[model samples]
Target: MAEALNNLVQLMDPYLLQILVNIGIAIILALGLNIITGITGQLSLGHAAFMSVGAFASAIITIRFNIPFGLNLLLSGLMAAIVGAAIGFPILRLTGDYLAICTLGFAEIVKVVFLNMDITNKALGLTVPTPKSPIPMPIYVWLVAIIAIIFSSFMKDSRFGRALKAIRDDEIAAEAMGINITRYKIESFALGAFMAGVGGGLYAHFINYINPSDFGFLKSVDMLSMVVLGGLGSIAGTVVGASILAAAPEFLRFMSEYRMLVYGGLLVFLMVFRPNGLLGGVNFTDLVLRSLGRKPAIAEVREKQT
Candidate 1:
């Protein structure tokens, strides 16, 4: 058994390395969307627009100016955040369905602009300059994972995250409690966009090719699906959600044309059976404790009190 296990590990090492990198990128995308729809109660279909903006912006800067990859990523995310803030001012005033439609419109507009823009080569797409030396995928993946962990941890514990949650649960009550709803919502939305932009920048660099079609409504929906399937408000759940959705298609390639049908059907089944998702907003730490046969600390405390 030991020898077999060692052989399996040796065989799986390279694939595992690649999967880790992919998971890091997926986590960034999923967690970013979580801040928007999961935390702030905003439905945005324009996340892909923000991502495209970031991807193109980073690619252009890096290609033209020969900037460092890290700087390119940061600047791209900042630009996307600025755009998000600019658009948020007008469209965020709309609520629920109105908000959704406005964001959808925004995404479409961004797509059309990219399609027509001469700078982007008029829909032919632009080639991103590859790094001079190949950085092992695992290293980049670790960097992204660290960034994601820091961001998720900060947002999960910060006052900003709490305010956003309040807005999600009860907007009116949150406002009554003296929370600045508009500011918080806009901030959350922009932050989400910023993360999406960073993810896009990484994606562009990794793939070294992109087109307007890459960032569309379907992409936004896919991100949303990750957030929902992982458990709306859970960061860990988002990672799991993204992994399953992203990797499942590849694994099901043997089915070919029926793959998508199976995927969709599986999603429907999951929604029907577990509406709250796999982890239902719980974190990995909590899950680990439960798996170790420990009850929730709060529950134990309540029992003691009784």
Candidate 2:
């Protein structure tokens, strides 16, 4: 099955194949942000900082240490998680827009630090080594994206996920109910950073380039937008939102210079017309079944709305 998928992917137009891979990367990044800002209800604007860390770490490991491709990815994630834990404790104390601004500052700091660091090679950037694995990179990205989606979904149904949601809805009540708000917040931020790091590692290998400019504040905003526009805390919504947003530029290429204007307008329109997002608290599968006049596999996630 794997070989067949690779062969089929090989048959696709190279640009289209790249777009598919891009979507997978977007899914991973958006899901990571969803964990932090959506499920955990903690605003983060420095997610790209984690991604930058992973990208540079993976690139450095690949070039200097000559570690195997897979190890590089894992190490990058670990590196990002460590950094996340380092920053999360102090920063997670802030809530709402204040927290967002703090994270944003953190992101800018990371970018500037990377810009000055000799190990990161300053602005020149590092070139990722070519993969030695037989599996095509796009396939690896999709597989990892699938794993991330499953992990996120499982987290949502786990005890920890419930705690996070409780804190999100009402931190005081959650604390009163015996939830360790601080610990859960740190865990969510670190785990989300880890996922973003892994996604960055994949992107580094896929693009074969890394620079501080690539993972700046704007990149963080894009990931956050994917989560918010997909319906916070909704896994299916994240997937659909990532797909649409990631693919929009390619689809709008015919509009030339107006593409970006149209893109921004479209997002604004969606926000205005559907404040809850495309999926909101609703399950995509449930919505589909309802449209088909059949019972849905999973019930709607009405807790947030109710």
Candidate 3:
């Protein structure tokens, strides 16, 4: 029994490591989507396009120019951010379904362009050259996770994030409060695109391949699902949502054929039962504090005495 237990532990080590990496990527993707759809209330269906742009850009730069991996990732993210901001100019004018359709069309257009672009192999796809003596997958995953956490933390408290929330709550009221709605919208779009790009770069390196087909409308839908499942405005919820959605299928391999159906059914059930999601609008920090039996500052004994 002890020998069997040791064997099981050995077998699980690698898979556990892989799951950690997947969790990091999922968190980055979910958090990025949340900024656009959750905070800014923009239903974008072209996020995969931005991700592809980053993936391809970083892959090409690393392969062709032999640039440092970090610089390549940064440049790729910046390129996607620029594209996102530029696209947001005209598309942001539309609202609701119209906006969604436009974003969907944008993703399709990007895919089509890549499909015909000879530089990207004209529908064949491109192989990313793996880094020489690359960092361990676990380390890379931790780095990305740290990056996502830092970005989320910064945005959660920033003026920009507040502006985004205002826009989401009521665009007209936000504008009335002297917020530059257009600027905030553009900023939100760009920020989301940037994160998506970083995630894409990580994905490309992790997979070591890229193709137009990988960034389809369905990919966008998956991202949207992450945001919705996590709770629209909750960062911690987004992380949980992404982790579960990403890992659920793998854990349910016995029901592989019915996976999509199960996912859809669960989504429907969740929306009907708890429209706000598991955590609703609660932030992760607040959730953790409450879990630890901590009270709000106003309710603390010291504060109350003061």
Please identify which of the two predictions, 1 or 3, would achieve the higher TM-score against the true structure: 3
Worst 10 residues of 3 by lDDT: 1-10
Residue 20 displacement (Å), model 3? 3.2
Model 2, 171-261: lDDT tens per residue? Answer: 9999999999999999999999999999999999999988899999889989988998899989998999999999999999998899999
Q: 42 in model 2: Cα distance from truth in Å?
A: 0.7
lDDT of 1 by residue, 1-306 (tens): 545544554566675656665667777878888888877889888889999999899888877887666777889899999999889988887789999999999999999999999888768998987754334434655577677866775676578788899999999999999999888888988888898888888888777898999999999999889889989888777878988987877778899999999999999999999899877768655565689999866678899999
Point to the candidate with the largest TM-score. Answer: 2
- Whole-model Cα lDDT of every candidate shown, in order: 0.82, 0.90, 0.83
Residue 245, candidate 1: how far off, in angstroms? 0.6
Better of 2 and 3 by lDDT: 2
lDDT (Cα, tens digit) per residue for candidate 3, span 256-279: 899878978988998899899866
Residue pairs of candidate 2 with colliding backbone atoms: none
Tell me the TM-score of each prediction against the true structure.
0.88, 0.92, 0.89
CA error at residue 126 for candidate 3, angstroms: 0.8
Candidate 1: deviation at residue 224, Å? 0.6
Please name the candidate that would achieve the greatest lDDT relative to the true structure. 2
